[model samples]
Target: MSDALSEAIPVLLVAAPILAATLPLVFGLRFDRAGWLFTTLTTSSLFVATVVLATVVYSEGTVIHQLGGYPRAYGIELVADRLSTTIALLVTGTSAGVLAYTRLGGPRGNTFYSGYLLLVGGLLGLTFTGDVFNMFVFLEITGLATYALIASGDGPESAVAGLKYLIVGTVGASLYLLGVGLLFMATGTLNMIELAEAIPQAQGGYENTLVRAAFAFVFVGFAIKVAQWPVHAWQPDAYQHAPDGVTPLVAALVSTVSAYALARVMYTVFTVDFLTQTPYAREIVITVGAVSVVAGSTLAVIQRDVKRMLAYSSVSQFGLVVAAYGLVTETALVGAVIHLVGHGIMKAGLFIAAGVIALGYGARTVDEYAGLAARRPVVAGGMAVLLIALIGIPPSVGFVGKWYIALGAVQAEVWSVAAVIFLSTMLTLAYSARLLEKMYFTPANWLEDPHAPDADVVATDGGSGPGLTRQSDRARPDAVSIGMLSIVVVAAVLAVALGFSGDLFYDWLEPFVSEVFN
Candidate 1:
């Protein structure tokens, strides 16, 4: 492809969704449900665009598009490097795939899909933008759309969850903005590439209180956004209460992208040299990640609600990614990227399977899944595959990522972090095994009478006690659609298929990692 065309791809990718987002509301005037069709077409085209962008990136190298033909220092830059392109592909592809589920299982409306496309646009912008301030702007856009989507769920609890996410998400974004402000104060620039060059030359260099304080604020901000332990209070509520269709999208991409942003800021803007020279910077990052791993896994083991359990699982999974970031080795960085993509795929599939089970069998809690394998074999089988992948079983994408992470830790001789990774695997197995046993070994008790009025009502509370019941509403369908089932199966197949492609992942990522580390 020509350079000009390649550069234009990122701009079009970001603009298409944001501009298309308005069409849903406009078209809503005449058609009752034009949103899904528009969304499907838009997301499908975006995915194809990402594939072309990814092709250009991997074959030719990083593509930088300067907005309005201005220099990087003044103009907003959209970057489609190996890293960003990979993430952009995930954002687009997953957005399209989840539509398969939302088409039939819905919180459907034009407004819901407008938020959906807006969220996609925000995520793509986040992935491609090279300016810190623009990143923050995209962050807020993503957060707003997420809040609206979460609140669109069936009950008042969804609204409450959305409100909680809004408050917490706002604070997280504010902290990130404050960090950006500090960096701008220190370096007088907001472009990531410029900041990287300037931060080392700033007053007092790495030891500048401004620089260190900026890292602190930024790390903490993304920590909350990624749902790290102690600052993760808002996540379980958000995930458990979000519409089933919405949960898959948010759970898979939102925090994953946030974690990617955190990594970008760490290695690109701040650079590994800063972490190496600054006292306690690497130590603090590693510590937080390690602790979150343990805390999140322990929390997951105790949750009776399946969605909440999976929510905490994300905390643990992302902890691994964060810890790998602190390791600072090329191997570890590859592991982090691989895990980010793998986790997104696995989590999206798992949540979709959860929604399918809920729709077909009315099982939400761990105990409620008894003999699910016998009743809804396809979904149960898919969930089992995803859960096993989550546990890092060999030849699954999960294992590929964890293997690299573990190898990286061993090479770094951070035996402590290595130990945490092993322990996390065991803890993951604990929770996954619990659900697996319930699905396969336990007798089927979840078969409810079709005539019973309360048959579809499941407890919304994450097993804290008797809580608000989720009523069967127009948003939820009585049966799972083929599209939903197909998505689950496809995710399972990809989880295992991608496992064999670890070498390819490593090679594709090597150029980017080398650029950062060397």
Candidate 2:
């Protein structure tokens, strides 16, 4: 492909979704169900474009499209290197895949899909934009769209969760913006590549109080965005109460991209040399990640709500990624990226499986999952595979990422973080085993006959005229679609299949990692 065409792809990839976001709402007056179709089409095309862009990037090197042909010093740039394109693929492909579930299992409406598209656009921009300030802009766009989508749920709880996320997310964005302002004051630029060149030449180099404070603000901001411990109170409520259709997307891509942004700022804007010279910078990052791993896993073990459990699991998983960032070795960086991708895939599948089970069997809690293997065999089987993968079982994607990270920690001789990785694995096993026992071993005594007029009623005498009846508030089972089942199965297959691709990922990421470290 010509350089011009390759450059145009990023523009199209970012703009297409934002522009198409309006189509569903505009057409809703005449066609009520247009949102799904439009989203499916837009995301599908974006995925194809990303693939083409990826080919060009791998073949030609990083593709930089300076907006309106302006110079890098002043113009906003969109970059498609090995790292950004990998994340772009994840964002677009997952956005397309989740539409299948939403089509039948509603939170359906033109407005819902509009917010969905807007979220996708924001994530893409976040992935591709090469400016520090624009990153904050995209961050806020993503947050607003997420808040609206979370609030689209049927219950008032969804609204409350949305409000909580909004307040917390805004604080995160504000902190990030303040960090960007500090960077500007220190370096006189907003572009990432420019900031990278200028930061070292600034007044005090790495020790500049302005530069250190900027990193501090940026780090804390992303800690909240990524739901690290002590600041993660918003995540469980948001994930647990979000519309079933919305949870998978937010859980999978939102924080994954935020972590990616954090890494980008660390390496691309600040570079590795600054980190090496700066006192306590790397240590602080590693400590935060290690602490989150322990705290998040401990919290997850006590959660009865399945969705809430997974939310906390994310905190633990992402903690590993953050610690890998602080390790500063090539292997750790590779491991971090792989883990980010792996966790996103696994969590999306788990949440989708949760949605499927809730629809087909009306089970939501850990106890409610008893005998799930018998009731919804396919979904339960898929969920089982996902949970096992998440526990770092061998020959699975989860194990692949964790193995790299553990090896990286040992290579760097960060023994404390290494031990934390092992501890997290055991803790993850605890909760996963609880669910596994419930699904496969425990009997479903709470489940009554499908034909029973009152599903909650128990006939004390087996057929007596007046038996004692039990009262319950759970919703009745709704029909599950084949499409929903297929998504879960595909996610399971990919999780295991990608486990064998560790070497391939390392090779693919080598050029980018080499550039940053060198």
Candidate 3:
């Protein structure tokens, strides 16, 4: 690609989705079924745009476009580097993939699709923006669309979850904004590259109080947005209560992008040199990540709700990425990027499977999943593969990412952190095995009690059962179509296929990594 083409790619990547976001609501005035077509077309176009940008980025170099032909020093810029483009590809692909499920498995409305496109636009903008204040604007856009989507579910609980997420998410964004203000106060620029160069030259340099406070607030804010450990209270409820079609998209992209933003700010804005020179910066990052890993998995093990368990699982998965950043090696950074993409794919597949199971068999818990394979073999098989991959089994995306991070830790000689990375596999398995056992080994009949009083067993879904009440009983199985099942299968296959492509990712990212760390 030429220089002109490269510059245009990032703009299209961000702008196309936002322009398309308005179409569904506009076209809804004339047609009731416009949303599906518009969403499919918009996301498909965004996916293609991402692919082109990725090609340009990998083959040529980072593509930087100054908005309105302005210079980088004082103008807004969009950057499609190796890392940002990789995330852009993931965001667009996941958004398009979820349309397969949403097409037939509903929450089908023009407004829902409008919010979907807005979320996509937000994620794309978040990925491409190279200005700190611009990133804050995109973050709010992402949060607002996410809150609306979460509340679109059938039950009242969805509203509560959406409100909680909105409140917490707003705080996170606000803190990030405050940090930006401090950085601007100290450095007098909001452009990421400019801020990075200005930081070390600012009045007091690395030891400056304003810079240190800025880093603290920004890191804490992103920690909340990423839903790490103690601050993760909003995620489980949001995931559990979200509409099935909405869950897969939100589960797959939202936190993953937030984590990516955090990494972007840490590396691109603050620069690795700051972490190396600053007191306690690396230690605090590593400690926060390590604790989130242990706490997230432990909490996941105790969760009875499948969606809630998967939500907690994201906490642990992202913890690995955060910990990788603290290692501060090229390899560790590569691992962090790979894991972010891998976790997005795996978790999206898991949530889609969960949604399918809920729709097909009314199973929403480990116990409810007994004999799932017998009832829906394809969905069950896909879920099992995803669960195994999530445990970091060999020849899977999860394994590839975790392997790189652990190797990076060993190279850096962080013995304790490496131990935590290795032990994370066992912690993940504790909960995965529980679900696997229920799905493959236990009898479904155990769910029924012959001695139970008649009042306890109530009719669910028009006399189909006198059984235990299920949260998933709200969804009708007949609405689930083949497209939904295919998305899950495709995600599973990609998870395994990408495992063998670690060398490819490393090669593509080599230039960017060298630029950042060398």
Candidate 4:
């Protein structure tokens, strides 16, 4: 125990963000600069801590820190295993990059920066938390922040979208809490490790209707949070209406992490033996995941709104993540984790890029992207690479992640699952190609005149000219900021870099995944 304490790092991972979350409320009334500075400093510090945590965990094994110096079942705990550390680093790193991008585009006008920082803090807390109730608390913090961020978007629709998300999110959280209460009642323990050990051996054969109902409720709640297929009507609206800069963050963090949490519960809290023994648990996940892939892809293909399209693509990709969890194979689960990281890089990069283009050219439809590569080669080219990666082409992170998942699907002989994934890939290519073709082949003359089509346009910073200001202005951009450009470069490089790192990273993750069975 002392040895575990000695190795503890990233222990203050939550402190930086939580402190920053409060800083805005305290000083934001006087000066916004104070809030921005606090947000930046804390988020950057959190990133550094996560990096340190990942390095230490990768080299020295897991790091476990007990919060408030309390024992299990009493205090909150943070564990920096390879998996948790990996996600922590990604979450913080992505937050830092996205926050930087949004700031460059002037997202601090509202409580955007403050809410964003708190959201980052909450997600970091959720990833590392070892206490069940602690997880729920952190989830609400993130969930509320997410609603705030979405509501802060460009128009009234954002408010509507935020309202729906808030209602549904609250309900999901309540259901999850109810399930947690049941588990606590059953075992008289709230510690996850204790519950894991104590759940299976309980009296009356353990697999009662009550326990099953609890599992169903909790899993369903998480499923909703992650935008599982039929429950996904809110995502397109949320993504479509969100500020362009923040769209990537929502797609990458909020949705992916929720799915990861569900997987964590299925494996960690209810052990595989328990879930497998529970009638229809794994099959249900597979069926729902498959339906999500198919439905989400089909919806994406018909959407003219680029943000909405990418939003649906994420739904489909995350569906694959959920399915991998349900496949009940070590390989499949590993695929899920890899895809989680890989898809985060891919989808977020594209969202930010789309935001860049939309702000620049006032183009959203597949038909309007004519000859963008000729004008802004870096942004267009970067998006092209990201879109390819999103479709799972080789020598990119997507390819590596997809390879693992496809292998897992084959191993399980889930042909319908395989078919859905495969068809979705084709649908992804079709939509992506529509964008590429518009960028490459379509003539520049086809672009709609920003002034002619819409005289009531908002001129942002990077737009037409210095004097080109409107009374009803919100944006300052005809293009993305330099900070956002920097983020795109970093994420794009990572998308390709992971292909090279695939062998080693997969090897590292393989053993950890296999441990779920033991």
Candidate 5:
């Protein structure tokens, strides 16, 4: 491809959403109808673009885009290596599924749809952008869209949660900006590649103090954005209280992209060599990751609200990915990158299932999920697949990530952390199995004794959270909507498809991870 063409790739993917967003907001002033038309067009196009871009990166290696056609060192650049494109593809593709599902089974309003499109676009922009400062701009856009989406929920709690998210989100953005400023002072360049090249040289120079301060600020700021351990106070409520349709998008994309940025900063800008040079830097990354894995999972186990449980679960998953990348080994970074993709798929599916349930019966608690399979079999089954995948069970994509991550931990002999990982896996299985048993094996006592004397199973949407409920004496919900079923099908298929594609992923990731030290 020509240089001009290559330079346009990042903007191209990002532009699809921005251009579509403005047209809908302006043209559909009164009607939300424009949201659907625009969302469909934007997400659909972005998906295709991601596929093409992924193929290009896999074939030709990293694809770099410089804004305004400036020299590599002088201009802001977007580099869609296998890493960025993989995450970008996940964000775009998952958003497409969410929008499609809501469009069909959700509240049929243009306002909601437009916000969804804007959110997806913002996330895509954040994921693909090359400049650190530009990332902050896109990050704000994403945060704003998220707050609006969450606030659109019918309940007051949704608004409150959005407000909290907004506040914390602002702090994160401010800290990120502060870090960017520090980095600029340290290297006089905002381009990631250039910073990576320039940062190491500052170790003993006049820029050394600024470099360290910048690293500290950026690292912590990204940690907050990604919801790592200490800074993760806002996640559960923000996730659980968001509108059902909006939960999955935030969980899957927001957290995943933040994790991606963390990895990029640590491995690319800070570099493995930089960590070895910088005092106590790698320690901070690995330590926080370890703490997050344990803390997030521990918190998840106690969450009765399904959405919150999954939200906490993401915190743990993301932490492990971060920790693995910090290991800085050949296969470790690959494990981290691959997990970034896997978690997005699994979490997206899980939350979508939660949303389906909430819409069905205003239910959000784990205990309330009892008999879900008997009610909405398709949604329940889809949720099962995602949960199993989350537990790292065989024949699902989740296992693929865990396998590599554990392998990395073993190779590096981080046994305590590995054991914790193992324990968390079991915890995941325990919770996953809880849902399965609830859906498939609700206790005989709670269930009406069909044969008992004068046993009356009062008909209230068959008792397990909402949607597709069947009362004892009334008609059961025949099935979940095709929109939800479609989302289920996509995630379920990928859960299995990813397993068989290990060889392909391994080959794709091998070169990228291997060349990291270079």
Candidate 6:
């Protein structure tokens, strides 16, 4: 790629989706089917752009693009480094993949695709933005688009869920803004790299009241945004009540990116040196993450609703990431990034599988999964693979992340945190095994009467929002597409395939980590 092309890629990643988002709504005035095709094309193009950007990042190191002709210190900049590109790929790839599910699965219409494209743009901007204030702007954009998407479901419940998310998400954003304000007060710059330089020179070094308060507010805000335990009440409702198509996108990327942003803030902005210099900073982060791991898993194991269970599972999965961050070692941070990507793919696949099961087999709860393998072998098998991966079984994406995180914990000699990391595997299996057993070993139960009604109705409405479908619509297999199934299989394959590439990921991250840590 030429220097100019390489420089333009990051900006294009954000701009393409935003510009394309308008095309669907405008083109809809004349053609009804424009949204899906346009959105798919746009997402696919963005994916290619991300791939190119990744190659540039690998060969040339971090790619920085300053807006207009302004220099890095004063102007808005977009950065495509190893860390950002890894996440940018996940955001773009997953958004494109989920379109296969959304195409025939309802939530159709140009307006819905408008929100979809906007969400994609927001996520990309979030990944690439180089300024703290610019990050906050992208964060709000992401939150707004996400709220609208959640509310686009068919039922009143979805609206309520979206509103709840909006309110809680607003508070989190406000706190993050407040933290940014404090940092600005302490150091007159809002640029992340500049802030990193200025923070140590603040009134009290790491112990400065302004800097300490800034960290506290920023950490708390992200804890809420990432859905850590105690502050995670909004997540279950949002995931469970959003349209099936929306659930996977939100599940896979929304919180995942927020967690990524938190990592960026901690390391890129605060730096490892800050954590070492600050009193009890590492302990507080580790404790919050450790407790979230235990609490999230315990809650997940007891939930009857599969979506809600998966929602709680994210809480635990991200807890592992957060804990890894607290470990503050290169291995642990690398593990955190790997886990973030791995968990995103695994959860996306799992949710897509759950939707397939709900739509194809009318199985939404654990009990409904009895003998699922006999009825829908491919989906059942795919889901089973994802679940096993989630349990951190060897040679799976889940295991590689956990292994490094746990190893990092042991190396740090944070014995309790390490214990939580190890114990998390068993905790994950507690829920995973229940679904696995029901899917494979339990005998199929058939209705005695061919005309018997379904015990529970799973509705698939035409509108863009989420609600329980009526039994007749829920069990219709014709609505499910082969493309959707293929995406699930692909996600499962990647989860396992990426596991073997852990060392490659670690080495790719070495230069980035060294730049930050040194």
List per-prediction Cα lDDT, in the order shown. Answer: 0.91, 0.91, 0.89, 0.78, 0.77, 0.90
Name model 4 segments beyond 4 Å from true: 1-10, 25-31, 204-206, 446-479
TM-scores for every candidate against the unseen true structure: 0.95, 0.96, 0.96, 0.92, 0.90, 0.96
lDDT tens digits by residue: candidate 3, 1-518: 67997798888878887888889899999999899999999899889978988877767778899999989878999988989989999999999998998887778889999999999999999999999999999999999999999999877889999999999999999999999999999999999999989999999898899999999999999999999877889999999999989998998899999999999999999999999899899988988898889899999999998999998888888888888988888889999999999999999999999988887676777777887788689999999999998999989999999999999999888887899987788989999999999989987773362211222343433444423333434445576789999999999999999999899989988888888885
Question: In candidate 1, which residue pairs get closer than 3 Å at backbone N, Cα or C atoms, i.e. clash?
Answer: none
Candidate 4, residue 436: the lDDT equals 87
Q: How displaced is residue 344 in candidate 2, in Å? A: 0.6
Judged by whole-model lDDT over C-alpha atoms, candidate 6 comes out at 0.90
Off by over 4 Å in 6: 447-472
What are the clash counts of all predictions, listed in order? 0, 0, 0, 9, 4, 10
lDDT of 1 by residue, 1-518 (tens): 89899999999999999999999899999998899999999999999999999989878988999999999888899999999988998999999999999998898889999999999999999999999999999999999999999999877889999999999999999999999999999999999999999999999999889999999999999998998888999999999999999999999999999999999999999998998898888888889899999999999999998999999999999999999999988999999999999999999999999988777666788987887798678899999999999999978999999999999999889999999999999999999999999999998653442212245433332343323234222223455888999999999999999999999999999889999997
Candidate 3 wrong stretches, greater than 4 Å? 446-477
- Write model 2 residue lDDT over 387-462, tens digit each, in one string: 9999999789999999999999999999998999999999999999999999999988755433222454433433
Model 6 RMSD, rounded to 1 decimal: 2.7
Candidate 1, position 307, lDDT: 95
Residues 1-518, candidate 5, lDDT per residue (tens digit)? 66566657778887778667777677678765777777877788888888888877877778887777788666767778877888888988998888755765554577677688778778887887788888888889988998888888766788898899889888988898998998887788888778888887665642388888887888888888889888998888898777667887888889788888877777777777877666677667788988898888888888887888888888899888878876777676777877888888888788887766765533467776766677577888888878888898888788888788888888878786688679879777766787788778884244433311123433433455332232232222332467777787688778778866666777887776666667
Cα TM-score of candidate 2: 0.96
Residue 41 lDDT in candidate 3: 91
- Give the lDDT of residue 493 in candidate 4: 85
Decide which is better by lDDT, 2 or 5.
Answer: 2
Candidate 4, residues 1-518: lDDT per residue as tens digits?
A: 24544445555777677767777777878886676677677777777767766666666777888876788876777776777777887788787777656765645553677788788878887888777777789889989999999998656778999999899888888888888887777777777777788788665435866567768888888878898889888888889888777788888899877877787778888888877787798889988898888889888888887889888888888888888888787777877888899888887888888877776666666766777788778888889988888888888888787778878888988877778778878988988888889888877763253421233444333356432332123223443678777778788889988877777877777656767778
